[model samples]
Target: MKKSLIALAVIAVSGTAFAQSSVTIYGKADIGVARSIGSDVNELKQAAGSRVGFRGTEDLGGGLKANFTYEHRFLPDTGAVANTSSFFTGRSIVGLEGGFGRIDMGRDYSAAFWTALAGDVFGYDGVAANGGVAGAGYQTVRFDNVISYKSPTMGGLTLEASSALKEAGAKNGSAIRVSYASGPIAASIATEKGLAGQKYNGFGASYNLGVASVRALISKGESATGVESDGMLLGLVVPMGALQLKASYATLEVAGKDTVQQMGLGARYALSKRTDVYTSYANNSKSTAAKKNGIEFGVQHNF
Candidate 1:
């Protein structure tokens, strides 16, 4: 009887410890077939960047918590690594969180990336995405060896900042962003200085009504030699039950270079909570070249 009692006591203690910690395994996969106006061949493609990841959190006393995430991208069609050289190619983060806010150190995203994503309907990885304009002119993406901080929201306003340390004679990069979201309105502004003497600034905003949401962003950048360029993107989203409609337009104008424009439309139908079917079409036009159009049909599932 005593041995059984001791076994039950051990099980109870172990269960309580696990109740204070949680871990989750999550991933998304998307694949599609696409055709372009100029090409007669159909190609297999990853509609959006496919990724798998693990995340966990542990609660500590005094309102503090420890968190971690490890993620990587892959090509679903071929089952090949998308990041190639890096293992945790999507995001590898370790951080601490509390009332004062959260601080993380790892290979992570830039402040300008968050700003651009604030108004992008299709995000950066999609075929019909509008982030190309901003991404082309700025390093509004991931950074290696970064330390970042995000403050707690106050009156719907939040602040974020990040820094990448210098290495091998390279210049240090830094970025900052301020954002506000309340009710039907959202807005953000960000600026960054990347290595190789590149500088960028961006602003974005969006408004939501009962049936639709509209968003827009503009970015300006300068190269190492002082050549300047500007980019703009506009997007709209409409939701009807389990179906959604998305559209966007983007433009980029560079000094001493031809202007580029793109327009895209897409639709998504949710089959369940974790699976969806989507299709998109995009037209690309260049001032000095012929126009091209592409279409994509794909399915996505999350687990």
Candidate 2:
């Protein structure tokens, strides 16, 4: 009888401990058929980078918690890894959060990238993707060996900063962003420096006016050799029940070089809460080169 009582007691304690922690498996799968710029062949592609990820959190009392995330990106069409060098190319991070906000270490997105994403009406995917303009003059999307912090939101405003170590003789880089989001207005400004003498500054803003959302972005990049480029984007999104319409125009100009411009149009329809179908068209033109156009039709699912 005593042994039985002890076993029950132990089980109860274990259950309580387990209740303090939680883990979630989440991912997105997106695939489509498209013809890309400068290519005459239509092929399978990812409208959005497909990825699977695991995230967990543990409560440690006093409103503090420990958190971790691991995300792997892949090509849904061919079942191949998205990045050849790193398995967890999406995100691999461990962090803590509490009243003091959150701090994370490992591979993570840069502050400037987040700002750019805010102004992309297409959410960074599809043939109408604004990646070329949004990410112009910026470092790679994710940084390795990075440490980052995000402050608690105060009156619709928050601050974020990050620093990446100089591993393998790589240049040390740092970035900071300040953002505000309340009601129908969202805005952000970010800057990054010290990546192989590259420097970038970006600003993005969006306003929702019931019928539509308008977004704008501007960025400037300077290289070590003194070459500079400026980029600008304007976009809009309109929602009509389950269907959404999007359009955007962007331009990039380099000193002493030709200017490049892009125009895009897209539409997405929600099939359900977790699935959607989309189509996009994009045109690219350069002052010194022939114009190119591409189109895609795709489906995306979240799980």
Candidate 3:
């Protein structure tokens, strides 16, 4: 009886500690059908990057808090893991937040990604990604074994920096981003350095005039082997009731080659606060090849 009483007391204490923390489960499911010029059959696509995650925060007192997040990506079509070898390929992070700012360590997006995605009309979605169509590609989406820091916003300015530790012979990566958002204007400048001296720099800005918004981004990339590429993107978004219309044009120029151009148009309709349907079309034109066009339609749900 004495031992049992002690066990119950311990359980109660543990329960109380758990109650001090808040945890939430969230996920997104998105799938679509896409048709391209060279495909014999239309392919199903993961339009919004399906993911499930848990995030929690614990008030540790003294104006400081502990936070953690774990997320995994999966394919809704086949119910298969996006990265079979790594369970939490999407993100796994833990850190602290206080008056100074926030710092996290684990797998997280590079600073450059935040900047690029901010200016992207189509985001980094597969097939229609602005990175592939215009920017320096999605080469710096996420980094493992990383430490990132964010400064508190002051005077409409915020700063972020991150570094990835070298693991498995992969080169160390580092990135920085500076952003400002005030009233109807927002802008960001970001840079990244990857293994083998690959470097990327980008600047983006957007302005909203109530009725519509315009966004643009320019990026330069240099390969370790001395080749260079420059990219530019321009996009517009218009909102009408529950519907949004978007159009974008992008160009990529490589040394001694004709510029590659891509154009995209899309529309999204909101069925509710948590569900939406979208349709989009993209055309990629290269100087040395026939133009390839793709069309997509899909629905997404968040919970």
CA lDDT of 160 in candidate 2?
94
Q: Which RMSD values do the candidates have, in order?
A: 1.9, 1.8, 3.5
Task: Give the clashing residue pairs of candidate 1, or none.
Answer: none
Q: What is the TM-score of each candidate against the true structure?
A: 0.93, 0.94, 0.90
Worst 10 residues of 3 by lDDT: 130-139
Candidate 3 local lDDT, residue 140:
77
| Stretches of model 3 off by over 4 angstroms after superposition | 1-20, 37-40, 287-291
Single out the weakest 10-residue window by summed lDDT for candidate 1.
Answer: 284-293
Per-residue CA lDDT of candidate 3, range 1-303, in tens? 999999999999899888878999999999999875334468887778899999999989888999999999999999999999878988899999999899999999888888778767888674455665344642377888999999999999999999999999888999999999999999999999865677778899999999999999988887777778888889999999999998888888777464657788899999999999998887777634353777889999999
Candidate order (lDDT): 2, 1, 3
Q: Local distance difference test, per candidate?
A: 0.85, 0.87, 0.84
Q: Across residues 136-241, which tens digit of lDDT does each residue of candidate 1 receive? A: 4765588788898999999999999999888776677889999999999999999988867788888999999879999999988888788888888899999999
Candidates ranked, most accurate by TM-score first = 2, 1, 3
- Which numbered prediction scores highest in lDDT against the true structure? 2
Among these predicted structures, which one has the highest TM-score? 2
Tens digits of lDDT, candidate 2, 1-303? 999999999999999889999999999999999987666789999989899999999999999999999999999989999998999999999999999999999999987778878877887887778775776655457788999999999999999998999999898888999999999999999998746778788899999999999999998877778788888999999999999999999888777564658889999999999999999998888634343888999999999
